[model samples]
Target chain A: MGRGMKRWMLWLPLAVFALLFAVVAAGLFRPADRTVRSAMIGKPIPNFTLPGMVPGKPGLATATLTAGRPHLVNVFASWCVPCIAEAPQLMRLKAMGVPIEGIAIRDTREDLLGFLRRNGDPYERIGDDQRSAVQVALGSSGVPESFVVDGAGTIVLQHVGDIRAEDVDDIAAAVRNAK
Target chain B: MAALCIALAAPVLADPSTPPAALAYTQLRDPAQEATAKALMETLRCLVCQGQSIADSDASLAGDMRSLVRERIAKGENPASIRAWLIQRYGDYVTYDPPLSAVTWPLWLAPIVLLAVGALLARQSFRRRPR
Candidate 1:
Protein backbone atom coordinates (compact mmCIF):
# COMPACT_ATOMS: atom_id res chain seq x y z
CA MET A 1 0.00 0.00 0.00
CA GLY A 2 1.07 3.61 -0.48
CA ARG A 3 2.80 5.32 2.51
CA GLY A 4 -0.04 7.80 3.03
CA MET A 5 -2.67 5.02 2.82
CA LYS A 6 -0.73 2.88 5.34
CA ARG A 7 -0.43 5.85 7.70
CA TRP A 8 -4.19 6.51 7.48
CA MET A 9 -4.97 2.82 8.09
CA LEU A 10 -2.80 2.83 11.24
CA TRP A 11 -4.54 5.95 12.56
CA LEU A 12 -8.02 4.49 11.92
CA PRO A 13 -7.80 1.99 14.81
CA LEU A 14 -6.43 4.69 17.12
CA ALA A 15 -9.31 7.01 16.18
CA VAL A 16 -11.91 4.29 16.79
CA PHE A 17 -10.40 3.41 20.17
CA ALA A 18 -10.30 7.05 21.19
CA LEU A 19 -13.96 7.51 20.25
CA LEU A 20 -15.00 4.42 22.16
CA PHE A 21 -13.05 5.52 25.21
CA ALA A 22 -14.59 9.00 25.19
CA VAL A 23 -18.16 7.75 24.85
CA VAL A 24 -17.77 5.12 27.55
CA ALA A 25 -15.97 7.52 29.86
CA ALA A 26 -18.61 10.22 29.45
CA GLY A 27 -21.37 7.78 30.32
CA LEU A 28 -19.44 6.60 33.35
CA PHE A 29 -18.81 10.15 34.59
CA ARG A 30 -22.26 11.59 33.93
CA PRO A 31 -23.46 13.99 36.65
CA ALA A 32 -24.78 12.17 39.71
CA ASP A 33 -26.80 15.02 41.24
CA ARG A 34 -30.14 14.06 39.70
CA THR A 35 -29.75 10.45 40.81
CA VAL A 36 -28.49 11.37 44.28
CA ARG A 37 -31.25 13.94 44.76
CA SER A 38 -33.99 11.55 43.72
CA ALA A 39 -32.55 8.73 45.77
CA MET A 40 -31.57 10.65 48.86
CA ILE A 41 -33.71 13.77 49.11
CA GLY A 42 -36.70 14.45 46.86
CA LYS A 43 -38.44 11.28 45.74
CA PRO A 44 -41.66 10.12 47.34
CA ILE A 45 -41.79 6.96 49.42
CA PRO A 46 -42.63 3.68 47.68
CA ASN A 47 -46.31 2.84 47.44
CA PHE A 48 -46.23 -0.69 48.74
CA THR A 49 -48.60 -2.52 51.03
CA LEU A 50 -46.65 -5.73 51.39
CA PRO A 51 -47.26 -8.52 53.88
CA GLY A 52 -45.49 -7.99 57.18
CA MET A 53 -42.52 -10.23 57.97
CA VAL A 54 -43.48 -10.44 61.64
CA PRO A 55 -44.48 -14.03 62.57
CA GLY A 56 -48.12 -13.51 63.49
CA LYS A 57 -49.42 -10.90 61.02
CA PRO A 58 -50.32 -10.99 57.35
CA GLY A 59 -48.97 -7.78 55.73
CA LEU A 60 -48.79 -4.12 56.62
CA ALA A 61 -49.90 -1.78 53.88
CA THR A 62 -47.74 1.27 53.15
CA ALA A 63 -50.81 3.31 54.03
CA THR A 64 -51.18 1.46 57.34
CA LEU A 65 -47.56 2.24 58.23
CA THR A 66 -48.04 5.94 57.48
CA ALA A 67 -51.74 6.17 58.35
CA GLY A 68 -52.02 7.71 61.77
CA ARG A 69 -48.82 9.70 62.32
CA PRO A 70 -45.49 10.68 60.90
CA HIS A 71 -43.12 7.69 60.82
CA LEU A 72 -39.58 6.77 59.82
CA VAL A 73 -39.25 4.25 56.99
CA ASN A 74 -35.85 2.60 56.59
CA VAL A 75 -34.73 0.66 53.50
CA PHE A 76 -32.08 -1.95 54.25
CA ALA A 77 -30.64 -5.02 52.55
CA SER A 78 -28.89 -8.08 53.94
CA TRP A 79 -25.89 -7.58 51.67
CA CYS A 80 -25.22 -3.91 52.33
CA VAL A 81 -22.28 -3.25 54.66
CA PRO A 82 -23.63 0.21 55.49
CA CYS A 83 -26.88 -1.34 56.70
CA ILE A 84 -24.90 -3.43 59.15
CA ALA A 85 -23.00 -0.35 60.29
CA GLU A 86 -26.27 1.53 60.95
CA ALA A 87 -28.00 -1.23 62.89
CA PRO A 88 -27.18 0.24 66.25
CA GLN A 89 -28.54 3.62 65.16
CA LEU A 90 -31.80 1.97 64.12
CA MET A 91 -31.95 0.16 67.45
CA ARG A 92 -31.32 3.42 69.27
CA LEU A 93 -34.17 5.09 67.35
CA LYS A 94 -36.52 2.27 68.25
CA ALA A 95 -35.47 2.50 71.88
CA MET A 96 -36.08 6.25 71.81
CA GLY A 97 -39.68 5.54 70.67
CA VAL A 98 -39.39 6.45 67.00
CA PRO A 99 -42.02 4.57 64.96
CA ILE A 100 -39.53 3.01 62.56
CA GLU A 101 -40.65 0.69 59.76
CA GLY A 102 -38.43 -1.26 57.34
CA ILE A 103 -38.39 -2.48 53.75
CA ALA A 104 -35.96 -5.32 53.15
CA ILE A 105 -35.12 -4.87 49.48
CA ARG A 106 -33.90 -7.68 47.22
CA ASP A 107 -33.38 -10.16 50.03
CA THR A 108 -34.92 -13.54 50.75
CA ARG A 109 -37.23 -14.04 53.71
CA GLU A 110 -34.71 -16.30 55.46
CA ASP A 111 -31.89 -13.88 54.93
CA LEU A 112 -34.02 -10.94 56.07
CA LEU A 113 -35.01 -12.81 59.19
CA GLY A 114 -31.39 -13.74 59.87
CA PHE A 115 -30.27 -10.15 59.38
CA LEU A 116 -32.88 -8.89 61.82
CA ARG A 117 -32.03 -11.56 64.33
CA ARG A 118 -28.30 -10.99 64.03
CA ASN A 119 -28.58 -7.20 64.05
CA GLY A 120 -31.58 -6.97 66.41
CA ASP A 121 -35.00 -5.99 65.02
CA PRO A 122 -35.47 -2.25 65.34
CA TYR A 123 -38.48 -2.05 63.08
CA GLU A 124 -42.03 -2.19 64.33
CA ARG A 125 -43.14 -3.36 60.88
CA ILE A 126 -41.00 -4.96 58.14
CA GLY A 127 -41.87 -5.44 54.48
CA ASP A 128 -40.42 -8.17 52.24
CA ASP A 129 -39.30 -6.55 48.96
CA GLN A 130 -37.36 -9.37 47.36
CA ARG A 131 -37.99 -8.01 43.86
CA SER A 132 -36.85 -4.44 44.70
CA ALA A 133 -40.08 -3.02 43.20
CA VAL A 134 -40.72 -1.05 46.36
CA GLN A 135 -37.11 0.11 46.43
CA VAL A 136 -37.30 1.29 42.81
CA ALA A 137 -40.54 3.15 43.48
CA LEU A 138 -38.96 4.87 46.45
CA GLY A 139 -35.99 5.88 44.21
CA SER A 140 -33.43 4.27 46.50
CA SER A 141 -29.92 4.45 45.00
CA GLY A 142 -28.74 1.73 47.35
CA VAL A 143 -29.47 0.20 50.74
CA PRO A 144 -29.78 1.93 54.13
CA GLU A 145 -31.99 4.84 52.98
CA SER A 146 -34.33 6.43 55.52
CA PHE A 147 -37.41 8.52 54.80
CA VAL A 148 -39.55 10.58 57.14
CA VAL A 149 -43.20 10.53 56.19
CA ASP A 150 -45.80 12.93 57.52
CA GLY A 151 -49.28 11.98 58.75
CA ALA A 152 -50.61 12.99 55.33
CA GLY A 153 -48.31 10.51 53.60
CA THR A 154 -45.92 13.08 52.15
CA ILE A 155 -42.24 12.28 52.37
CA VAL A 156 -40.76 15.11 54.44
CA LEU A 157 -37.14 14.05 54.43
CA GLN A 158 -34.97 11.34 52.91
CA HIS A 159 -31.55 10.23 54.12
CA VAL A 160 -29.28 8.21 51.86
CA GLY A 161 -26.62 5.86 53.13
CA ASP A 162 -26.20 4.80 56.79
CA ILE A 163 -28.16 6.74 59.35
CA ARG A 164 -26.05 8.14 62.16
CA ALA A 165 -27.51 8.99 65.58
CA GLU A 166 -27.70 12.67 64.74
CA ASP A 167 -29.59 11.88 61.50
CA VAL A 168 -32.12 9.93 63.54
CA ASP A 169 -32.64 12.92 65.82
CA ASP A 170 -33.00 15.27 62.85
CA ILE A 171 -35.46 12.97 61.13
CA ALA A 172 -37.43 12.53 64.33
CA ALA A 173 -37.59 16.28 64.77
CA ALA A 174 -38.75 16.69 61.18
CA VAL A 175 -41.43 14.07 61.67
CA ARG A 176 -42.60 15.82 64.82
CA ASN A 177 -42.60 19.23 63.17
CA ALA A 178 -44.23 18.04 59.90
CA LYS A 179 -47.72 19.50 59.58
CA MET B 1 -0.50 -13.97 14.45
CA ALA B 2 -1.86 -17.04 16.24
CA ALA B 3 0.51 -16.49 19.15
CA LEU B 4 -0.47 -12.80 19.32
CA CYS B 5 -4.18 -13.71 19.51
CA ILE B 6 -3.50 -16.14 22.35
CA ALA B 7 -1.50 -13.55 24.22
CA LEU B 8 -4.26 -10.94 23.80
CA ALA B 9 -6.96 -13.29 25.06
CA ALA B 10 -5.00 -14.85 27.95
CA PRO B 11 -6.06 -12.29 30.55
CA VAL B 12 -9.69 -12.60 29.46
CA LEU B 13 -9.58 -16.38 29.90
CA ALA B 14 -7.56 -16.42 33.11
CA ASP B 15 -9.31 -17.13 36.41
CA PRO B 16 -10.09 -13.82 38.15
CA SER B 17 -8.68 -14.57 41.60
CA THR B 18 -7.67 -11.10 42.73
CA PRO B 19 -9.26 -9.80 45.92
CA PRO B 20 -11.75 -6.94 45.62
CA ALA B 21 -9.93 -3.65 46.20
CA ALA B 22 -11.00 -1.11 48.80
CA LEU B 23 -12.22 2.32 47.70
CA ALA B 24 -9.68 4.38 49.62
CA TYR B 25 -5.94 3.66 49.91
CA THR B 26 -5.44 5.71 53.09
CA GLN B 27 -7.84 6.28 55.98
CA LEU B 28 -9.67 9.59 55.83
CA ARG B 29 -10.97 11.21 59.02
CA ASP B 30 -12.62 14.29 57.59
CA PRO B 31 -16.34 13.74 57.04
CA ALA B 32 -16.51 16.23 54.16
CA GLN B 33 -13.60 14.67 52.32
CA GLU B 34 -14.96 11.21 52.90
CA ALA B 35 -18.35 12.21 51.53
CA THR B 36 -16.78 13.81 48.47
CA ALA B 37 -14.63 10.76 47.84
CA LYS B 38 -17.63 8.47 48.16
CA ALA B 39 -19.67 10.59 45.77
CA LEU B 40 -16.80 10.85 43.28
CA MET B 41 -16.28 7.10 43.29
CA GLU B 42 -19.96 6.46 42.68
CA THR B 43 -19.90 8.87 39.74
CA LEU B 44 -16.52 7.83 38.33
CA ARG B 45 -16.84 4.94 35.94
CA CYS B 46 -14.77 1.84 36.45
CA LEU B 47 -12.79 1.43 33.22
CA VAL B 48 -13.41 -2.31 33.40
CA CYS B 49 -17.14 -2.19 34.15
CA GLN B 50 -17.80 1.00 32.15
CA GLY B 51 -21.21 1.28 33.84
CA GLN B 52 -20.20 0.92 37.50
CA SER B 53 -18.25 3.14 39.85
CA ILE B 54 -14.82 2.30 41.22
CA ALA B 55 -16.65 2.14 44.55
CA ASP B 56 -19.17 -0.44 43.27
CA SER B 57 -16.72 -2.32 41.04
CA ASP B 58 -14.62 -5.26 42.19
CA ALA B 59 -12.01 -4.84 39.42
CA SER B 60 -8.33 -4.55 40.39
CA LEU B 61 -8.00 -1.27 38.49
CA ALA B 62 -10.95 0.24 40.37
CA GLY B 63 -9.20 -0.65 43.60
CA ASP B 64 -6.07 1.04 42.33
CA MET B 65 -8.08 4.16 41.49
CA ARG B 66 -9.56 4.16 45.00
CA SER B 67 -6.13 3.75 46.53
CA LEU B 68 -4.90 6.60 44.37
CA VAL B 69 -7.61 8.83 45.75
CA ARG B 70 -6.63 7.90 49.30
CA GLU B 71 -2.95 8.46 48.63
CA ARG B 72 -3.69 11.88 47.14
CA ILE B 73 -5.79 12.83 50.17
CA ALA B 74 -3.08 11.61 52.53
CA LYS B 75 -0.71 13.98 50.76
CA GLY B 76 -3.02 16.86 51.87
CA GLU B 77 -4.52 17.36 48.42
CA ASN B 78 -8.08 18.65 48.43
CA PRO B 79 -10.80 16.60 46.74
CA ALA B 80 -11.31 19.21 44.00
CA SER B 81 -7.59 19.34 43.27
CA ILE B 82 -7.26 15.57 43.30
CA ARG B 83 -10.17 15.29 40.89
CA ALA B 84 -8.57 17.95 38.69
CA TRP B 85 -5.29 16.08 38.65
CA LEU B 86 -7.02 12.83 37.72
CA ILE B 87 -8.90 14.54 34.92
CA GLN B 88 -5.66 16.04 33.70
CA ARG B 89 -3.87 12.71 33.67
CA TYR B 90 -6.76 10.42 32.68
CA GLY B 91 -9.02 12.83 30.81
CA ASP B 92 -12.57 13.60 32.00
CA TYR B 93 -13.30 9.86 31.74
CA VAL B 94 -11.57 9.23 35.06
CA THR B 95 -14.20 11.27 36.91
CA TYR B 96 -17.92 10.90 36.98
CA ASP B 97 -17.82 14.64 37.60
CA PRO B 98 -17.35 16.64 34.41
CA PRO B 99 -15.78 20.02 34.93
CA LEU B 100 -17.79 22.97 33.60
CA SER B 101 -15.07 24.39 31.42
CA ALA B 102 -14.19 25.10 27.77
CA VAL B 103 -12.61 21.69 27.14
CA THR B 104 -15.80 19.98 28.27
CA TRP B 105 -18.14 22.25 26.28
CA PRO B 106 -18.66 19.56 23.67
CA LEU B 107 -19.56 17.04 26.39
CA TRP B 108 -22.23 19.35 27.81
CA LEU B 109 -23.54 20.45 24.43
CA ALA B 110 -23.12 17.25 22.41
CA PRO B 111 -26.77 16.29 22.27
CA ILE B 112 -27.97 19.73 21.19
CA VAL B 113 -25.10 20.25 18.82
CA LEU B 114 -25.66 16.87 17.17
CA LEU B 115 -29.37 17.52 16.86
CA ALA B 116 -28.76 20.89 15.23
CA VAL B 117 -26.17 19.48 12.86
CA GLY B 118 -28.46 16.64 11.87
CA ALA B 119 -31.32 19.06 11.16
CA LEU B 120 -29.06 21.28 9.07
CA LEU B 121 -27.65 18.36 7.10
CA ALA B 122 -31.11 16.95 6.48
CA ARG B 123 -32.36 20.32 5.30
CA GLN B 124 -29.42 20.77 2.94
CA SER B 125 -29.60 17.24 1.58
CA PHE B 126 -33.35 17.36 1.09
CA ARG B 127 -33.31 20.82 -0.54
CA ARG B 128 -35.16 20.85 -3.91
CA ARG B 129 -32.87 19.49 -6.68
CA PRO B 130 -33.24 20.97 -10.17
CA ARG B 131 -35.93 18.86 -11.86
Candidate 2:
Protein backbone atom coordinates (compact mmCIF):
# COMPACT_ATOMS: atom_id res chain seq x y z
CA MET A 1 0.00 0.00 0.00
CA GLY A 2 1.09 3.57 -0.70
CA ARG A 3 1.89 5.99 2.18
CA GLY A 4 -1.42 7.84 1.47
CA MET A 5 -3.38 4.54 1.61
CA LYS A 6 -1.66 3.59 4.88
CA ARG A 7 -2.59 7.00 6.36
CA TRP A 8 -6.27 6.52 5.17
CA MET A 9 -6.52 3.06 6.79
CA LEU A 10 -5.33 4.43 10.16
CA TRP A 11 -7.92 7.25 9.99
CA LEU A 12 -10.72 4.82 8.88
CA PRO A 13 -10.65 2.82 12.13
CA LEU A 14 -10.41 5.99 14.17
CA ALA A 15 -13.44 7.41 12.36
CA VAL A 16 -15.39 4.17 12.92
CA PHE A 17 -14.49 4.12 16.63
CA ALA A 18 -15.53 7.78 16.98
CA LEU A 19 -18.88 7.06 15.28
CA LEU A 20 -19.49 4.07 17.54
CA PHE A 21 -18.62 6.11 20.63
CA ALA A 22 -21.01 8.87 19.57
CA VAL A 23 -23.87 6.40 19.10
CA VAL A 24 -23.24 4.78 22.48
CA ALA A 25 -23.02 8.18 24.16
CA ALA A 26 -26.29 9.24 22.59
CA GLY A 27 -27.97 6.06 23.81
CA LEU A 28 -26.62 6.51 27.32
CA PHE A 29 -27.17 10.27 27.78
CA ARG A 30 -30.24 11.14 25.69
CA PRO A 31 -32.38 13.76 27.40
CA ALA A 32 -34.59 12.22 30.11
CA ASP A 33 -37.05 15.12 29.70
CA ARG A 34 -37.96 14.16 26.11
CA THR A 35 -38.37 10.48 26.92
CA VAL A 36 -40.65 10.94 29.96
CA ARG A 37 -42.34 14.29 29.25
CA SER A 38 -45.44 12.87 27.54
CA ALA A 39 -46.19 10.40 30.32
CA MET A 40 -45.36 12.53 33.34
CA ILE A 41 -46.60 16.05 32.68
CA GLY A 42 -49.74 17.55 31.13
CA LYS A 43 -50.95 14.40 29.36
CA PRO A 44 -54.64 13.49 29.46
CA ILE A 45 -55.57 10.57 31.67
CA PRO A 46 -55.91 7.25 29.83
CA ASN A 47 -59.48 6.40 28.80
CA PHE A 48 -60.47 2.78 29.46
CA THR A 49 -63.49 0.80 30.70
CA LEU A 50 -62.46 -2.81 31.13
CA PRO A 51 -64.32 -5.76 32.65
CA GLY A 52 -63.73 -6.49 36.31
CA MET A 53 -62.10 -9.72 37.55
CA VAL A 54 -65.47 -10.86 38.85
CA PRO A 55 -67.85 -12.12 36.20
CA GLY A 56 -71.05 -10.36 37.26
CA LYS A 57 -69.88 -7.42 39.36
CA PRO A 58 -69.53 -4.01 37.72
CA GLY A 59 -65.85 -3.55 36.82
CA LEU A 60 -64.05 -0.25 37.25
CA ALA A 61 -64.43 2.14 34.36
CA THR A 62 -62.34 5.16 33.35
CA ALA A 63 -65.59 7.10 32.97
CA THR A 64 -65.97 6.67 36.74
CA LEU A 65 -62.51 8.28 37.18
CA THR A 66 -63.17 11.94 36.49
CA ALA A 67 -61.39 15.30 36.54
CA GLY A 68 -63.77 16.36 39.31
CA ARG A 69 -61.52 14.97 42.09
CA PRO A 70 -57.84 14.16 42.50
CA HIS A 71 -57.15 10.43 42.26
CA LEU A 72 -54.24 8.02 41.89
CA VAL A 73 -54.15 5.34 39.22
CA ASN A 74 -51.82 2.36 39.57
CA VAL A 75 -50.82 0.07 36.69
CA PHE A 76 -49.78 -3.37 37.90
CA ALA A 77 -49.62 -6.99 36.77
CA SER A 78 -49.71 -10.29 38.66
CA TRP A 79 -46.56 -11.51 36.93
CA CYS A 80 -44.54 -8.45 37.92
CA VAL A 81 -42.53 -9.16 41.08
CA PRO A 82 -42.09 -5.44 41.86
CA CYS A 83 -45.87 -5.04 41.93
CA ILE A 84 -45.92 -7.51 44.83
CA ALA A 85 -43.26 -5.47 46.61
CA GLU A 86 -45.41 -2.32 46.29
CA ALA A 87 -48.64 -4.01 47.47
CA PRO A 88 -48.11 -3.15 51.15
CA GLN A 89 -47.29 0.44 50.25
CA LEU A 90 -50.52 0.61 48.27
CA MET A 91 -52.40 -0.73 51.28
CA ARG A 92 -50.77 1.96 53.40
CA LEU A 93 -51.95 4.58 50.88
CA LYS A 94 -55.47 3.14 51.25
CA ALA A 95 -55.16 3.28 55.03
CA MET A 96 -54.28 6.95 54.65
CA GLY A 97 -57.61 7.35 52.78
CA VAL A 98 -56.12 8.01 49.37
CA PRO A 99 -58.41 7.25 46.46
CA ILE A 100 -56.54 4.68 44.37
CA GLU A 101 -57.71 3.03 41.17
CA GLY A 102 -55.88 0.16 39.52
CA ILE A 103 -55.26 -0.89 35.90
CA ALA A 104 -54.29 -4.59 35.72
CA ILE A 105 -52.42 -5.17 32.46
CA ARG A 106 -52.10 -8.47 30.57
CA ASP A 107 -52.97 -10.71 33.51
CA THR A 108 -55.48 -13.52 33.88
CA ARG A 109 -58.56 -13.22 36.15
CA GLU A 110 -57.32 -16.02 38.41
CA ASP A 111 -53.88 -14.42 38.84
CA LEU A 112 -55.36 -10.99 39.57
CA LEU A 113 -57.82 -12.36 42.08
CA GLY A 114 -55.00 -14.33 43.65
CA PHE A 115 -52.89 -11.16 43.92
CA LEU A 116 -55.76 -9.19 45.51
CA ARG A 117 -56.49 -12.01 47.94
CA ARG A 118 -52.83 -12.33 48.95
CA ASN A 119 -52.28 -8.58 49.22
CA GLY A 120 -55.17 -6.61 50.70
CA ASP A 121 -57.18 -4.80 48.05
CA PRO A 122 -56.21 -1.12 48.20
CA TYR A 123 -57.94 -0.23 44.94
CA GLU A 124 -61.33 1.47 45.13
CA ARG A 125 -61.97 -0.03 41.69
CA ILE A 126 -59.83 -2.02 39.26
CA GLY A 127 -59.78 -2.26 35.45
CA ASP A 128 -58.80 -5.52 33.69
CA ASP A 129 -56.56 -4.62 30.74
CA GLN A 130 -55.56 -7.87 29.05
CA ARG A 131 -54.61 -6.30 25.70
CA SER A 132 -52.71 -3.31 27.15
CA ALA A 133 -54.89 -0.79 25.30
CA VAL A 134 -54.85 1.44 28.37
CA GLN A 135 -51.08 1.00 28.63
CA VAL A 136 -50.65 2.13 25.02
CA ALA A 137 -52.97 5.07 25.67
CA LEU A 138 -50.95 6.00 28.74
CA GLY A 139 -47.64 5.56 26.80
CA SER A 140 -46.29 3.27 29.51
CA SER A 141 -42.99 1.49 28.83
CA GLY A 142 -43.72 -1.06 31.57
CA VAL A 143 -45.31 -1.72 34.91
CA PRO A 144 -45.63 -0.93 37.74
CA GLU A 145 -46.42 2.71 36.84
CA SER A 146 -48.60 5.09 38.80
CA PHE A 147 -50.25 8.31 37.66
CA VAL A 148 -51.64 11.16 39.68
CA VAL A 149 -54.60 12.73 37.94
CA ASP A 150 -55.80 16.19 38.69
CA GLY A 151 -59.43 17.29 39.15
CA ALA A 152 -59.39 18.30 35.48
CA GLY A 153 -58.46 14.72 34.52
CA THR A 154 -54.94 15.71 33.44
CA ILE A 155 -52.15 13.36 34.41
CA VAL A 156 -49.94 15.60 36.53
CA LEU A 157 -47.32 13.14 37.75
CA GLN A 158 -46.15 9.60 37.04
CA HIS A 159 -44.05 7.11 38.99
CA VAL A 160 -42.34 4.36 37.00
CA GLY A 161 -41.19 2.02 39.76
CA ASP A 162 -42.43 0.60 43.08
CA ILE A 163 -43.68 3.21 45.51
CA ARG A 164 -41.71 3.59 48.71
CA ALA A 165 -42.58 5.41 51.95
CA GLU A 166 -40.65 8.53 50.80
CA ASP A 167 -42.68 8.65 47.58
CA VAL A 168 -45.92 8.76 49.60
CA ASP A 169 -45.32 12.38 50.61
CA ASP A 170 -44.58 13.45 47.00
CA ILE A 171 -47.70 11.69 45.71
CA ALA A 172 -49.82 13.23 48.50
CA ALA A 173 -48.40 16.65 47.67
CA ALA A 174 -49.28 16.15 43.98
CA VAL A 175 -52.79 15.03 44.96
CA ARG A 176 -53.17 18.11 47.17
CA ASN A 177 -51.87 20.34 44.41
CA ALA A 178 -54.22 18.70 41.92
CA LYS A 179 -57.16 19.35 44.18
CA MET B 1 -28.47 -21.93 1.89
CA ALA B 2 -31.40 -23.35 -0.08
CA ALA B 3 -32.63 -25.29 2.97
CA LEU B 4 -32.25 -22.11 5.06
CA CYS B 5 -34.24 -20.12 2.48
CA ILE B 6 -37.00 -22.77 2.64
CA ALA B 7 -37.03 -22.72 6.47
CA LEU B 8 -37.06 -18.94 6.50
CA ALA B 9 -39.91 -18.82 4.01
CA ALA B 10 -41.90 -21.58 5.79
CA PRO B 11 -43.33 -19.53 8.66
CA VAL B 12 -44.23 -16.64 6.37
CA LEU B 13 -46.08 -18.87 3.88
CA ALA B 14 -48.10 -20.88 6.40
CA ASP B 15 -49.32 -20.84 9.98
CA PRO B 16 -46.44 -21.56 12.42
CA SER B 17 -48.28 -24.62 13.81
CA THR B 18 -48.55 -26.15 10.33
CA PRO B 19 -45.41 -27.68 8.82
CA PRO B 20 -44.45 -26.23 5.46
CA ALA B 21 -45.50 -28.43 2.50
CA ALA B 22 -41.98 -28.19 1.07
CA LEU B 23 -40.44 -29.25 4.38
CA ALA B 24 -42.85 -32.22 4.60
CA TYR B 25 -40.97 -33.90 1.73
CA THR B 26 -37.61 -33.62 3.48
CA GLN B 27 -36.18 -36.59 5.44
CA LEU B 28 -34.47 -34.25 7.97
CA ARG B 29 -37.77 -33.71 9.83
CA ASP B 30 -36.58 -34.08 13.42
CA PRO B 31 -38.79 -32.77 16.25
CA ALA B 32 -35.83 -32.62 18.67
CA GLN B 33 -33.92 -30.42 16.21
CA GLU B 34 -36.98 -28.15 15.82
CA ALA B 35 -37.26 -27.73 19.60
CA THR B 36 -33.56 -26.99 19.87
CA ALA B 37 -33.89 -24.35 17.11
CA LYS B 38 -36.80 -22.67 18.92
CA ALA B 39 -34.94 -22.72 22.24
CA LEU B 40 -31.79 -21.21 20.71
CA MET B 41 -33.79 -18.46 19.02
CA GLU B 42 -35.53 -17.63 22.29
CA THR B 43 -32.17 -17.41 24.08
CA LEU B 44 -30.46 -15.29 21.37
CA ARG B 45 -30.59 -11.51 21.21
CA CYS B 46 -32.02 -9.44 18.35
CA LEU B 47 -29.37 -6.78 17.83
CA VAL B 48 -31.81 -4.42 16.13
CA CYS B 49 -34.44 -4.61 18.85
CA GLN B 50 -32.16 -4.48 21.88
CA GLY B 51 -34.96 -5.28 24.32
CA GLN B 52 -36.35 -8.25 22.37
CA SER B 53 -35.12 -11.83 22.12
CA ILE B 54 -34.45 -13.17 18.57
CA ALA B 55 -37.60 -15.35 18.84
CA ASP B 56 -39.75 -12.32 19.77
CA SER B 57 -38.38 -9.70 17.38
CA ASP B 58 -39.69 -9.15 13.85
CA ALA B 59 -36.38 -7.64 12.68
CA SER B 60 -34.50 -9.08 9.68
CA LEU B 61 -31.43 -9.72 11.86
CA ALA B 62 -33.67 -11.70 14.21
CA GLY B 63 -34.85 -13.76 11.23
CA ASP B 64 -31.21 -14.37 10.25
CA MET B 65 -30.37 -15.45 13.81
CA ARG B 66 -33.41 -17.78 13.81
CA SER B 67 -32.25 -19.31 10.49
CA LEU B 68 -28.71 -19.67 11.82
CA VAL B 69 -29.97 -21.35 14.99
CA ARG B 70 -32.14 -23.73 12.92
CA GLU B 71 -29.15 -24.68 10.73
CA ARG B 72 -26.96 -25.37 13.79
CA ILE B 73 -29.68 -27.45 15.46
CA ALA B 74 -30.18 -29.41 12.22
CA LYS B 75 -26.43 -30.09 12.19
CA GLY B 76 -26.92 -32.03 15.50
CA GLU B 77 -25.40 -29.34 17.71
CA ASN B 78 -26.76 -29.34 21.28
CA PRO B 79 -28.53 -26.14 22.39
CA ALA B 80 -26.15 -25.65 25.35
CA SER B 81 -23.08 -25.98 23.12
CA ILE B 82 -24.59 -23.66 20.54
CA ARG B 83 -25.30 -21.10 23.29
CA ALA B 84 -21.73 -21.45 24.51
CA TRP B 85 -20.47 -20.87 20.97
CA LEU B 86 -22.56 -17.68 20.66
CA ILE B 87 -21.37 -16.45 24.07
CA GLN B 88 -17.81 -16.93 22.86
CA ARG B 89 -18.47 -15.16 19.55
CA TYR B 90 -20.46 -12.17 20.87
CA GLY B 91 -19.57 -12.24 24.55
CA ASP B 92 -22.43 -11.95 27.12
CA TYR B 93 -23.95 -9.03 25.15
CA VAL B 94 -25.98 -11.66 23.21
CA THR B 95 -27.77 -12.59 26.46
CA TYR B 96 -30.20 -10.08 27.98
CA ASP B 97 -29.46 -11.20 31.53
CA PRO B 98 -25.71 -11.73 31.64
CA PRO B 99 -24.26 -13.63 34.60
CA LEU B 100 -22.71 -11.47 37.29
CA SER B 101 -18.93 -11.91 37.23
CA ALA B 102 -15.63 -10.03 36.74
CA VAL B 103 -16.60 -9.44 33.07
CA THR B 104 -19.74 -7.55 34.20
CA TRP B 105 -17.95 -5.45 36.87
CA PRO B 106 -17.72 -2.34 34.67
CA LEU B 107 -21.43 -2.50 33.78
CA TRP B 108 -22.35 -2.80 37.47
CA LEU B 109 -19.89 -0.28 38.91
CA ALA B 110 -19.05 2.29 36.18
CA PRO B 111 -21.92 4.63 37.09
CA ILE B 112 -21.05 4.86 40.82
CA VAL B 113 -17.34 5.22 40.13
CA LEU B 114 -18.00 7.84 37.45
CA LEU B 115 -20.18 9.83 39.82
CA ALA B 116 -17.62 9.65 42.61
CA VAL B 117 -14.75 10.70 40.34
CA GLY B 118 -16.84 13.48 38.84
CA ALA B 119 -17.68 14.78 42.32
CA LEU B 120 -14.06 14.71 43.42
CA LEU B 121 -12.82 16.36 40.20
CA ALA B 122 -15.56 18.98 40.38
CA ARG B 123 -14.56 19.81 43.96
CA GLN B 124 -10.87 20.04 43.10
CA SER B 125 -11.28 22.04 39.88
CA PHE B 126 -13.90 24.38 41.32
CA ARG B 127 -11.80 25.02 44.44
CA ARG B 128 -8.74 25.97 42.33
CA ARG B 129 -10.60 27.85 39.54
CA PRO B 130 -12.75 30.06 41.83
CA ARG B 131 -15.97 29.19 39.99
Tell me the DockQ of each model, to 2 decimals.
0.02, 0.02
lDDT (10s digit) by residue, model 2, range B1-131: 99888878833211112222222223236887776677667777765566789788764335545655666678788877867655643456676656668888788789999999799868977887794
Tens-place lDDT digits, model 1, residues B18-124: 23334334446777767667766677766556678888876545666676666566567777886765554345665777877788888889999989989986776
Candidate 1 per-residue lDDT, tens place, A61-158, comes to: 66764566878889887767788889998888888778788887656567667777899888877887644446545644456788788776777787
- Give the TM-scores of the predictions, in the order they appear: 0.49, 0.50
What's the TM for model 1? 0.49
Clashing pairs in 2: A67-A151
lDDT for model 2 comes to: 0.70
Q: Which candidate ranks first by TM-score, i.e. highest?
A: 2
Q: What's each prediction's clash count? A: 3, 1
